[model samples]
Target: MADYPRHPDREEARLDMSISQVWAAERISCPHRDILRAYLAGGLEAAAQDYVAFHLEVIRCPFCLANLEDLDAATSAEKEELRQRLGRAADRTVSSSAVFLERLRDSGAGG
Candidate 1:
């Protein structure tokens, strides 16, 4: 059996009794779920969006399409939840001049 969760809407779904079941996720190989989410969020660059578009629209990757659909169908609460999750994942980088000066001095350059 495939360890990865298959898309219910995929061709194989015809054989799956869970076809009528509504799932929140799908297991796919290409254009990882994150990329799909980023694509829907419009966070991806033009080229990246183009690639995902090709994968979902042209390649017809059911799993990714399903993810995209889910993202598109997200409610206000769901969108807020996702926004919070992304906010928590952000990096806190300090780019103060003191930090740069210290780095410069360590590198034998004038601070």
Candidate 2:
């Protein structure tokens, strides 16, 4: 079972990596999420003076940035709904496949 969250609308919600989400953040230290919020809100310079390496790496990762944009686009309720549906689908697939394999073994048809 895959533990990472998956979103079907990810491609649709993707945003280009702006300079705010990329450079100009390496010299400011802060929590990644906070830095992102601050950057979005025109407060990038207020992050800190120690330089945020990990946060900049996150911003530079295209996949991570796309997921972050998807998150930003979703309302709390919509995000929760998606999470619940994916979890339930994964659980159902796992359980059904296990039962089918067990039945196959009992019937002497297991691969």
Candidate 3:
């Protein structure tokens, strides 16, 4: 077996995705956090192609699709705030589900 040297400084370069492409990727509700994740995770070309299609503003309107870049710039506190918001949303959803289940039980529609 042969061993190869690895360089710790060798980090992958970032691709310049358009705002609209990022927006579409986001609006489409992909599982990953953002297109950058896809790019870094070995789908560089796919991510680039997605943005390239919208670079000319042909696919998505740039005016409405802007701000994707800034979406991930939150500080620790800001992230905490967002986490709290998501928690609240989840709590509300759970409460609603519980209420519905209770109603179903009351109506003898559930076991």
Candidate 4:
């Protein structure tokens, strides 16, 4: 075989590839969104919750952490929106009741 010059960064590239492969494997093992959501909601069983906690706290998987953060934010926003909607509905109900009561009084129905 003819001798060829080796690239100086070949080892570094190989190391980077190895690291990427490990990262890909870890990501593949990550729990799906539904499981993550259950974990967030405290709906998972003890064993499943423990596993998720280990993955998040010990492994510190960046992707899962980001997903969890996104889920939390979305949940908070939804709750706030629902609260505002309920508040508006309550205000409308109160206003309507007041108007009805005023009309009743004006018509001498309260006597």
Best by lDDT: 4
Model 2, 7-111: lDDT tens digits are 556543454234445443443323566555444445556434224334446444444455456546654567789999999999999999999999999999886
Candidate 2: the clashing residue pairs are none
Q: Write the per-residue lDDT of candidate 3 for residues 87-106, one digit (tens) a residue.
A: 99999999999999999999
Name every residue pair that clashes in candidate 1: none
lDDT of 3 at 85: 100
Clashing pairs in 3: none
lDDT (Cα, tens digit) per residue for candidate 1, span 2-102: 69976667667564434223221343336777788788778999999998887677556677777778767774569799888777655323345668778
Please name the candidate that would achieve the greatest TM-score relative to the true structure: 4
Model 4: CA > 4 A from native:
1-26, 106-108
Q: What is the C-alpha lDDT of each candidate?
A: 0.68, 0.57, 0.55, 0.88
TM-score of model 3 (CA atoms): 0.34
TM-score of each: 0.42, 0.33, 0.34, 0.66
Report the Cα lDDT for candidate 4.
0.88
